[model samples]
Target: MTALHELTAEAAIRAIEAGETSSLELVDAALERVTSDPWHAFLAVDEDGARERARAIDANGERPPLAGIPVAIKDALSTRDLTTTAGSRILEGFRPVYTATCVERLERAGGIIVGKTNMDEFAMGSSTENSAYGPTRNPWALDRVPGGSSGGAAACVAARQVPLSLGSDTGGSIRQPAALCGCVGIKPTYGAVSRSGLIAFASSLDQVGPLARTVRDAALTLQAIVGRDPLDTTSLEWREPIELPAGERLDGLRVGIISELNGEGIEASVRGAVDSAAATVESLGGAVEQVSLPSVEHSLSTYYLIAPAECSANLARFDGIRYGRAAEGADSLLEHYERTRDEGFGSEVKRRIMLGTFALASGYYDAYYLRAQKVRTLVVEDFARAFERVDVLMSPTSPTTAFPLGERTDDPLSMYLSDVCTIPMSLAGLPALSIPCGFADGLPIGLQLAGPAYSENRLLGVAHALEQALALDQAPPEPA
Candidate 1:
């Protein structure tokens, strides 16, 4: 018998349809893995609900695309029945009145929600340490930090606790974590996936996507989630579902390496890993060229400004007036709001909030926030121009591999640099994926491939070809 935990969603569906295994068997196996070992990946386990859903799917015989397959939803996305804490105390007992459209789409495609995975508080930090609950350790090496704010989501999939998981990428949150954890993450073009029920970090940049062990699984999950939604006006209008290339190769494809993304910022091992991945593509008859995006040098600064500005506005909704946690003993309404937010939000979140608030404040809005938005446009245009010359852009997902849990927590500027390579893509609203290409020391490294807007299918196709050539998705080292 096949180990139920090892089966991918597609494989599990095929097995269930063939009567080779029952949904209950798969669900029970997944529940066992999650319960016996405390991966610390999940914040809330919907064991009873998931089992009930599994039993229903088994009996009804109406299989969705991922019928009987278990998956984890990031805590950042709202679930009507599950607590939607974005790894913060502010929303500790919060449950959304309605489920996120992406979560609903997953259910429609026959995927079961196993649990709500943990994340950085309000999806602000690069490490899960910002999580009020506690940090999620890297599955490959428990001593290292799993990349965040999607760390729990990536760790869950990497550890095989869940074959598939969801993550929200604001600045490299999903892809970076996926790379570090030895999994695959797809951050679809901004607005490609609905952001309606996603707890906002930076409204314009935050995109919910899939984290899985294989490019196919990520593509399959993306196919289920990408489409226009009335709930989110900015959502992408992908009328036709994405159809991945069944067996694609890199022959004759043009791949661009962002020259700026390499060199000083990246570690030697990470640069080597990317160089190896590029060679793999070349061996498969793909043409690789060095491309330059001058505006990329300022992307980190621009992102910090734009993202925080938007975050300040988006987060203002949670002023203890109506939403989330409220201060218990405040005599005045103003005092209640101030105390609630000051007490509820973590230090990092508060820092960003203050920075963002200052940027958007009356005197500075034009000089800071508006100026950053203009810079954002230039960054997007640079990518657009580059795409005209190449089919896809490639880079190391992060400058370095997984670091020790508290390594850069004290130095905010150093932490910001981790997402430097990823922010440009988010700014441009391009689809990007990170697949395990190699490892540095004992930690995994991911090679990032990005395509133009609404090009998830093509991006995944390219990544799929690279995945086959590199075959770096091998068994990860046991946790320390």
Candidate 2:
């Protein structure tokens, strides 16, 4: 018999509906594993609350799709009554009065919130090292990092502490970690999911997504949380609910390989895995061809400028005046602001904030920020043109497998390059997913699939077909 903690969310729901398992049993099993978490995947655990909710659901005999499923939520999302830190010291110990819309919807659908997972402070870094609390180690290799800023969410699923989790992707936070951790993660089209209660980090780029052990589990999680919310003005309105495709064959599908992503900089092993995935897609009766998105070359540079600029403006709210930690014994208001921020934010957060402030400064504004926006437009146009030629695009999620922790902490450029293949799709506000394709020296390599806006159903369906055909074993080795 399989451990209850290792069951996928979809399977757990089935067990509950069949009367073979109770909600309390699942929550208890998950909580036990969480308590013994050696990777530091969780920041806080809500044992009492989770127990109460489980007991109520078991008593009511109403099993929703995720009725008894236990899920780990990224700390970036606000949870009422639970501290929502965004993994920063400044907002430490602060609880939101209202839960984030995505989280609320998940609970309403009967998913149990097991606890909050750790992340990079304000979702800034590619590796989980930027987290103020501490770094989250990859379950496969304890010395290596679980990619971030959604490292905790990915780690929990890969470690089997829970089969489903929620993560936020802004320039590859969710997908990169999923690839490194050997799980499935999806970043939905921007505005397809509400961002009302999520702590802002590059507001235009941040979108809530799901990370799970399987493709079907990820799709079901997305179905439960995606919808328009009145609180978020950017949320998209849709009359029909999104549905996962029931079919597995890609008889007439067209797949595109971005030319710019294949050349130099990508590791040989990573490239080889992508080629294999493309071959699998072709074998599934789909047409595969090379396509160009020239402006994608400038994605890293443009993303650094635009994302930091927006992060600088959005993070200005945490000046100790509103909520969060305030400095004690400040002689004047100016001193108070300086001390509060200096103590609250981590080194990486401070660096980006300074870079953003400099970019948006009076004389440099037109030269840096405005120019980056123009290049962003070109990148978006590049994707639009490529999509006209092909139905979907595929690439390596990262240039390499998980690297040793602290390997690139001093080399910020190397860390930024980790997200190179992922940022272009984010800039275009498209739906993208990362699925385990193969392994390199015992580490998993991810194959990323991306499509035009609001094309999640087709994207996931194609990925599911590839997943079935490749039949790669994604289980991580026992934690060290």
Candidate 3:
């Protein structure tokens, strides 16, 4: 019998249903893995809660789709059992009274909440080094970084600490780290998954998605998470599930290769990996065409302005009184807020808060924030127009693979550029995914596939086809 730790969520459910494994055994295995290198991924481990949930499920013999399977919820999401720090000192002991809607959904699907994973402070940085708790080392190469702000979540899944994990991607948080760690990650359409309990970095851009080891696993997790939520007004209800045809040959699939994603600023090895994957798609009967998203040039600038503006607003609620750390010697409420926030927020978080505050300020709102919003519309329209020509869009998940920790941290501009390829889609609120394509310098690389809004099923299908052809048996980096 396969050990519970080695099984996928789908496989775990089947095994439990078939009486092949007990929920306790699976939960214990996950707990053991988490305990083995607690620093690498988790911020908190709800061992007692997890075991109790597992025992309850085992007794009922009611295995929801992922019954008894362990899942690592990104620290950005609130959980009553665990501290929901956004990887910052400001939220060190902050635990929400209510669980996130997605967390509730995972429970309904029979998933055991293993723990909360670390991240870049408030999901601001590209590397997990920004985490107030310290960087999450790549499971593959201990010296290198696990990409962020979903780095810990991806690391947990890739390292086999859990079969599946949740991440909130404002930029490439989910996909980039998954690629770096040789795991599968999907950023569902914006608003496809509720953001009710997620710590807001960029409210309009942030989205919750899954990271797993396989396309099927990612799809399974997506199915469990996707749905409308009354709590989140942004959430939408699709009439039906986005189910791509299984075993469907990629022959004749219309794939658009974004010309802009290639050349200039792309690493030769990364380019080669993308080319090889594209060729694999061609061999499998998929036609790759050179399509352009002209507005992509403005994506970064628009994102910088828009994201910070929202971040400033959403984060204002963290004024030290209701949550996290508090500053001393404040006679006034405003003074208390300033002192608490100043003390609680990390440098990166402060940087964003200031930039966002400035952008939304009365004098600059028209020039910066409003202009960015207009450009956002254009960015979205660009994809809408491109999707008219192709079923899916392709790009490299990042310009480069996982860099050494702190390689780009000092240079915030360069670090922000790491998410260049991803923010455009997020601005457009479209579904995109990053799958492990190949390796460069023994480090894993990822190829991105995006689709129209609410086209997660189609994107997953396309990703599945590519995964089949690539036959990438990407193993997680051994823990240091």
Off by over 4 Å in 2: none
Candidate 2: Cα lDDT at 341: 98
Order of all candidates by TM-score, from best down to worst?
Answer: 2, 1, 3
| Candidate 1 Cα deviation (angstroms), residue 223 | 0.9
**Higher-lDDT candidate of 2 and 3:** 2
Model 3's TM-score against the true structure = 0.97
Task: Arrange candidates, best lDDT first.
Answer: 2, 1, 3
Tens digits of per-residue lDDT, candidate 1, 1-480, equal 668887877787788988999888898888887775455888988899999999999999886778888999999999996889899888888888999999999999988998999899999988788999999988878878899989999998888787899999999999999988989999998888999899999988999999998888888898899899999999979975787556557888899999999888899999999998899889888999999999999999999998988898888888776567889989998998889988899988998999999998999999999999999999989998998999999999999999998999999999898898999999988889899989777789989999988777778888888888787766655444
Each model's RMSD to truth, in Å? 1.3, 1.0, 1.4
User: After superposing candidate 3, which stretches have Cα over 4 Å from the reference?
Assistant: none
Worst 10 residues of 1 by lDDT: 471-480
lDDT of each: 0.89, 0.91, 0.87
In angstroms, how far off is 305's CA in candidate 2? Answer: 0.5
Q: Which wins on lDDT, candidate 1 or candidate 2?
A: 2
Residue 53 in candidate 2, Cα distance off native in Å: 0.7
TM-scores of the models, in the order given: 0.98, 0.98, 0.97
